[model samples]
Target: MALKTFVKISNISNLSDARYCAGMMVDVLGFNIDPNSSTHVAEDDFKEITEWVAGVKFAGEFHDSSIEQIKEAIKKYPVDYIEIADLDLVEKVGLLGKPLIFRLSITNEEDLSKIKSTLSYLDELTKLVLFHCDNENLFDQIDAQIGFYNGNLKLMKGYGITADVSLGNFPGLALEATEEDRPGFKDYGQIMDVLELIEED
Candidate 1:
């Protein structure tokens, strides 16, 4: 079987790892900017990354974000895709005419219903990255729901996707890790182990 690749961004500390893992097919990067905070990357960093990295696709992530904030981030950085967790914000930005990567946190059947309705408005999006919380069976249920879409949008899994999970079976699985708890954050050997697991079926 072929290997599945992904990128996860938690804090700015993971940027180095992301840069090292660049050139992979499915790359996930994040940018979180608070209106009054000066912690996250600045505009120059985004421009530098865009010029340095090539051939790798990025999914920009945001949390507790608003439409205006997201739009400003996208305008300054401009990645291959964008990840939004808020449904209402997604609906507001879906009308912007730019393709995005919507990240939905799956919890129950009702969330699926909401996704079905949201898809009707944001069908032009590049893909949907579903973040499953603690429930493995959720993937099976989502796979069935995805079938109803007739392959109109791609499905990528995230959140709680660890080395123990069978991700090889899911072609578009994206691994998400936090800077503090990430297995390979401090050790190269552990990172390779996680990568090996992802490549295995």
Candidate 2:
């Protein structure tokens, strides 16, 4: 199944999610690689899961790991993209020579301004910026500013996405993969509904 637009599934920890999203034809699958993160995927598990999937790029998700830590992590499991939540670490991570994805959570006007200003200065190496707003209204507010954004990176609305979404100026959307309740059983929830709606005809 092919999706109508670019899609990224983040925090994927299981082979079930990895293979499922890959079959859905999502563009990127993100795995939390920070050792300090509770959901961090170990090298062995990461290899095991990734080995079963094909036709998608992998993102080494780093929330607060230092450059040295990120560098070390990728050496063990190569990733096509580096995903980070901190804006300040973009430059340092970019030096790693991998396409970068910046994830941000905007709760207020101050947060929006800070991200907008910082994003305008980002270089081409920054491939995508995923924004998760506090509410649907804030998501609309960010969507309105897309035309004003002069940066080369693609912008994805990471929040307020529904099954009947109108993508408008943004390239696509981002969603988290749900954890399996039991080893073999899984409940996909709203993600399944949304993906079915956006499935390419």
Per-model TM-score versus the true fold: 0.66, 0.93
Give the per-residue lDDT digits (tens) of candidate 1, residues 145-175: 6556654555565644555765433345655
Q: CA lDDT of 151 in candidate 1?
A: 48
- Which residue runs does candidate 1 get wrong by more than 4 Å? 1-13, 23-25, 33-39, 44-52, 95-97, 112-126, 134-149, 167-170, 180-185, 188-191, 198-201
Per-residue CA lDDT of model 2 for 1-201, tens digit only, reads: 699889999999898888888998999999999977887999999999999999999999998898899999999988999999876788899999899998878888787677767677664558798887756567767777775776677887788777677778788789888789987688887778788898988
> How many backbone overlaps does candidate 1 show?
0
Clash count, one per candidate: 0, 0
Whose TM-score is greatest here? 2
Model 2 TM-score, 2 decimals: 0.93
Model 1 lDDT on a 0 to 1 scale: 0.56
